[model samples]
Target chain A: MNASTLWIFLPILTGALLLFLRNQRWVAFVAGGLSFLLALTAWLLPIETTLALGSYAFKLSSTFEILGRRLILTTNEQPILTLIYGAAAFWFIASPSVDKAHRLAPLGLVQVGVLVAALAVEPFLYAALLIEVAVLLTTPLLLSGRDKPGRGLLRFITFQTLAMPFILFTGWLLRGIEADPGASALIRQAAILLATGFVFLLAVFPFHTWIPLLSEETSPYLTGFVLWVFPTSALLFATGFVDRYAWIRTAPQLPQILSTVGALMVAGGGLMAAFQNNLGRIMGYAVILETGFSLLTLSLLKTQGIDLFFLLFVPRLLALALWALCLDILRQNAASLSLQDVRGLARPWPFASVGLIFAHLSMAGLPALAGFPIRLAILEDLATVSLSVAAWAFIGSVGLLAAAVRTIAILVAAPAELAWEARESWPQRLFIILGGLALFGLGAFPQWVLPLLNRLPAIFEHLGG
Target chain B: MLLNWLAGVLILMAGIGLFVSRDWRWNLGAMALQYLAAFWLVHASWPLAASAVKLITGWMACAALGMTLASARTEPGKEHGWRDGGFFRLLAAVLAGLVAFILATRLSAWLGIAPPIAWGSLTLMAVGLLLIGITTQPLRVILGLLTLLAGFEITYAAIESSELVTAAQSVITLGLALTGAYLLVAAKEETPQ
Candidate 1:
């Protein structure tokens, strides 16, 4: 396998060994160290290059046949693949605290599975099998210990599994059209099926209860991995179908459909999150809302939309990584994830809480944080379309921002009790510096990042302040 | 020629018998009859090579049944009725007929005959989804899921056949069934007499 393939699989290969390692600390250190090296390698790989399925050799730029179909990898995919795997590696490394408590091996395996699934051709169809494997993998995680499998995991699996047949049948139907191009009826059927399958998989509105339940049941770090990696991978994989099927991308009604669904998700999930008592659930809803925003951007059907999708993805991943890390470190002290439990938490763990607030604000798309730019860009794009469209985008942005404000309000409410003194850990301080540098870097010099994020889609590029 | 149709009718009848019969033994008999019908159907269609594979799968299934029966027999005789609420049985029966009829119609359509859209497959799928959606009873839902799956198989078989992907999909279904069975077995083990 070339570096791109190797970059994704290396951690997975090490995860197996992690299971056998007696010293959890060493497993954490080694796995993290190796993953960082791999991430660096991934970052260095030439963008938009394809590694043929049969040939291991690096083809700087070539498209060859695989099983009677062409599998092409372009420079556009390089940043995406690098960002996902590299970010995952960083999160896995930063999450040493949780790695000690839960078996990291299985979660790592699932992460790899999701990556492979996303990287695979026809992720729309392939995702079903991958999701099944993830469910199977989750069963052991869900069933771990004397703790009964919670309603959340059960619900998550049930909803996920139900979506499976839709995807498979959609694939089956779509496969038929290759031979019978005149089968317009069949094409429409496949599109509806595919759309529903994705809607269910992404836990789009009405199917979103599972996200909170799962986040609550699983370790925060693992939950963060699911929230960030899985959906992003699915979305990336979905882009392939959008790119491949002219009917889906070019359909006149498709963008409107996506926008409507997205608006509903944002409004519903945001409102729900605004009222939730549980922090994890709130984060879950926020992520769901963000997913909605992403969908809204995607519906624009421009390269700018894709770029915004990519740009929004980066900060969300970073924020969730920090969020999961904070939860992992603090879950031991809190009776529950309710704001009350976290009231005085910041006092004891100032750095972690600061990280949480930063992440939350970024999640909220506040200014100087990563979320702000993307949200603004999406809004600007919406304005060009219609006043009502811009209004809806504004409402969604407000909801996300409101959620963040609530979290900050809760944290600051009982600052004396919640504020945690920073530990003297040099490594943690280093991480804080890195996170701050990133936040500030993205914030102050929005210009430099805008070029990178602007490469997204035109809709987002126009929104760059 | 008539034997195939006869076997199909017998399987449908057995499925109905499973619904009406309160006795667990009778229900088992219906399942057994259904299995036999499946065996006959396979024998009538594919050559011995494919038949051999089906036969092996059948024998393995029989082994599982034997184990289930032996376990039940080993238990102390309680005055429990043989009835299984007949919910799954009824559901399964309705679904099987619906699926079979749908499959027949679709197969005819694919062969250039304009047969109607058999509502049977749709019914089977609907009932299966209902069973799975509403209930937490693993075994009942499993039976429902199996019925639903059978409906899918019929529709799929009518359209096209890629034995590899089909086999792969079947393996997944079987895996789900096995997981459900394990859950049932584990639950049975958990409860005290």
Candidate 2:
């Protein structure tokens, strides 16, 4: 069997099959197990080679062709596959802990399958259509039973659909550019259209209105999964673009533009996140900040930007997952996530409190937390590029730090008569404690995830030095 | 060549219908007709069999959306009238058409596509975006999406006659219809405070 069939098609069919099975917990374990297994297979197997399994001998080819297009999963892509599936497994396995998370179990698997196909598809133009399909698939996961589709969902669909045409138009132009790179006007137009497409997909400033709106309208837990998966895949898709096109990767001004955009997201997301009253929206802002950080990392493409970009996944996933878990737990007890509603919550929800605090601190890149060292390195490198960009990055961290402090103050703002108690269920407490410690574990020992992130650069041939 | 002009004119008319109508039934009718116009233009470049996919898929989506709205308890929104700024809506459509007409010449030459096809795609794209920009209601927004894609498809069909791209675009068309139905029924629940 080919890698595409085994990883992409099989999981989709399996997900369709799992839809009939109504046991949420059972489905979570099964899907999570399969995800882990797929990840492990990627880690262990060498593509485009024949291996003998005692008595059976067969080849596991890397390319699967259909409709005259190829989905190629080579040895170079092993790390990315492992990263995607490993992270999927983590999200799935941990999903059983949060309310409204059951929706993610089966549909989430299908979504991941489509996203993986988007990443693997050749003639990268097709990736735009695949990504749009993947975005539509996520609508159900975001909606609760009988709930109206929110404004966020509509704008989300609109912006995403709008991006496809631009990218497709770019693809049409790229053929012209490839035939004659001297077509300067075509090249300029293509670059602008391509960047606009990615800007929409990335939810850069003007387009980010949907993030907080969706967060406010839906469960934080569900929003977290979409926030993490779609943008990460989009960024990877963009890196693939940079890798393939000689003119794009060699463009002199691209880095400065990326840096400026990254700085904008950092400052805007961070400063805005600090002033928000709704806890869920704060999570949304953190996502925006994280995306900004990613763009900043990517701007360093001239150096080790790609490597730094990959390192972000491990800490970001851990932080968002932990943060989302705590918020979901709090959501069960409080009427709403507004400051007035969650006031003095820590007295009864100590473990959730700790988990939430650690997560917030880590995202703010506080020293001794998981995000610290990497944030420090990126900022140092960014400063060498331009101190103004570095200053904006620093201001962003401080803004997030301010938000973290404000959140702590509210959680501990207990009435005098209120007393501390561990009111969280055992499962909630266990996961939080473990998740919290994992953040610390990765922080103290960067080696735990750095090696995996280090290998991700192999997937791109020319872009990341 | 005359048939292409008639098809382009029909496209702009259907777009005008979509631009001002709030009633789901009328909107669907306009959309189905828009697809027919698109099919006629595309058939000039692609095989009849390939061109028919756009027609069939577009009608199927309209039928699906129509069934949902017929069964759906609420109106698509308040019916459009002078109070809803009908004159302004017509003005917008006219402006959009004018812009499309202006661009069609350059696009036809640069992309080496037919003038009729370029005009058809560009006009639909402009009107579709106008529809999306004006509406927040789910069904109308989705209609706008379908309209935009139809516009893209007309030109795209002429440029790249790949069956794979055609199928993928058709699936996207259907996916938008299904999702639109989903959002319509989903309106039963109120927004959380």
Candidate 3:
């Protein structure tokens, strides 16, 4: 197989082989080395043409086909795929330093499965299936000694499963329209189901109760994987449908509806996040609010909007990865995720606390950091469409910013209490330094990053649909 | 015309029997009757030879009926009386019936056995969405999911059938159902009665 195809599946194949290697140290070293090389190659190599497995191939660098109907991956997909696999590499590198969790091999394999789902043409059902399998994979990781299952895994599985029929059926409805050419009735039906599935999967508003609940129970690493990879993959998958189907793209008021839903999620998630004292739950809210902003960008429906959508991934992946790393550190060091427990942690674990703050700022879309340029681009696009949409988009950013600021304030002002006296290992300290540097690097010179994102729209302009 | 009338009668009788009947055994009987009615309706439009797998799936509904009976507690006198049980059973049966009816109508249209109507697939989906949205009880939710699945299956018949998506969905449905049933049993055990 060619490099592009090989790059995509190599990590997956290595992960599978790791299961029977009978050498943990060798597996960790070799796996980390191989994943780093593959990610480097995927980043450096020129994009390939269609790479097919059987009857189906990843047709567009952005799209694929499922069954008989097309499941388009948009041109916006490449940067996101790069970011995802890149972060997966980072997580793998850090895995050795983190706690000894079982089933490392399968965990990496599941990560590959999620990446494949992201690249899958019909992400509708296959993505959800991958998510369910991911959840099952985590059961062994999350539930070690406990005989009774926690509500967290169940809630996660239920919510994920609940979204399945919505997606599958929506796809079915859209296919039905193609059967009897030029049926407006089927179009509207497909649109509604599509929107409903989006809401269900995104955990928009009322359907989002599972986020904080599942957040509380799952580990920082797995929780971060669920929040970032799965949901972001879903967003990428949804982008395919909007990009490919001109009917969806051309819908008169659909963009407005999407923006409105996104704005609501931002406002609602922010308010809830502000009330939550738990760090993990706050991270969940922060991610949700950011998701709102992503949707808002998608709603603008312009080249800039597409660019902003692609741009959003960079900061989010870096910030969430750093944040999850910090959480993993804090959980091991402090055994608590409360703001109160983390107070005065700056004195002892200055590197981690600073990393957390920077990550939070990046997530908040603060100026100069990773999230700012993208959010700014989205607002500019929105302004071009309508002043009111721009205002709504701004309103969404404010909530995210407010939540981040609140997290920062709490991290600083809480009464000093020594919860645990733990020293950071050399590896943890190195990760914190690296993470901080990356955040500062991205924040200081977003121009360098903007060009990378700039490539996304060009790709989309040519072949996204 | 006679076949349509027979299908309609069987469905209606099964629906009423499911809701009004007091005995648990009668619930199984009504569920079986409803499946039979649905099978006949599915058969009337798509010939059995062409749709053997689906026909066998219809037969497997009998196994689902048996499984449901096994799942229900045998307590003759519980807080939820025959009335409550009957209402739920009937509600599930009716939702399934509505799904079957929509499928039959669409299939008939597809086969040129009936005049094509506007929004045929749309109407079925709308009904399924309504059922799923309104239900909270596990049994009802499963029924709602089945309704939603049926709507999609009929829609798929009009489109390309992917053994890929179908096989994937079948495995998922089986696993989900087993998980749901396990959860129900666990919930029953956990609740302080």
Q: CA lDDT of each candidate? A: 0.60, 0.87, 0.60
lDDT (Cα, tens digit) per residue for candidate 2, span A1-465: 899998899888877777788787888888899999999998888888889999999888988988988998888888888988898888888788774536887888898999889888888788999999988887888885578788988998998888898888899899999999999998999999999999899899899888888877777778888988988988888888888998998899988988999999999999998999988888888889999999999899888657888888889999998898898888889998998899999999998988999999999999888998899999999988889999998898888889889999999999999998999888788888888888898889888886677778899987544
In angstroms, give how far residue A112 of model 3 lies from its true place. 3.0
Docking class of 1: incorrect
Model 1 ranges off by over 4 Å = A1-13, A45-76, A100-102, A122-124, A179-182, A303-305, A412-437, A446-465, B1-124, B137-154, B157-171, B174-193
Best by lDDT: 2
lDDT of 2 at A463: 58
- On a 0 to 100 scale, what is the lDDT of residue B81 in model 2? 75
- Which lDDT tens digits does candidate 3 get at residues B1-193? 5664665566556545634454435544654565454445444445564334443453454356346446655332224555665567556646655565666666556534431211233333443454445534343344334434444444444443455555554445444445444444444433211
> What order do you get sorting by TM-score, best first?
2, 1, 3
Per-model RMSD to reference: 6.1, 2.0, 6.5
Local accuracy of candidate 1 as per-residue lDDT tens digits, A333-408: 6787787887766666677677777877777778888667777888788677656766766676577667667776
Runs off by more than 4 Å, candidate 2: B75-77, B189-193
Residue-pair clashes per prediction, in order, are: 24, 0, 2
Per-residue CA lDDT of model 2 for B1-193, tens digit only, reads 8899899999999999888776677788999999999999999999999999999999999988888777765455566577668889888998898899999999899888889889999999999999999878788789999999999999888778766788889999999998887787787442210
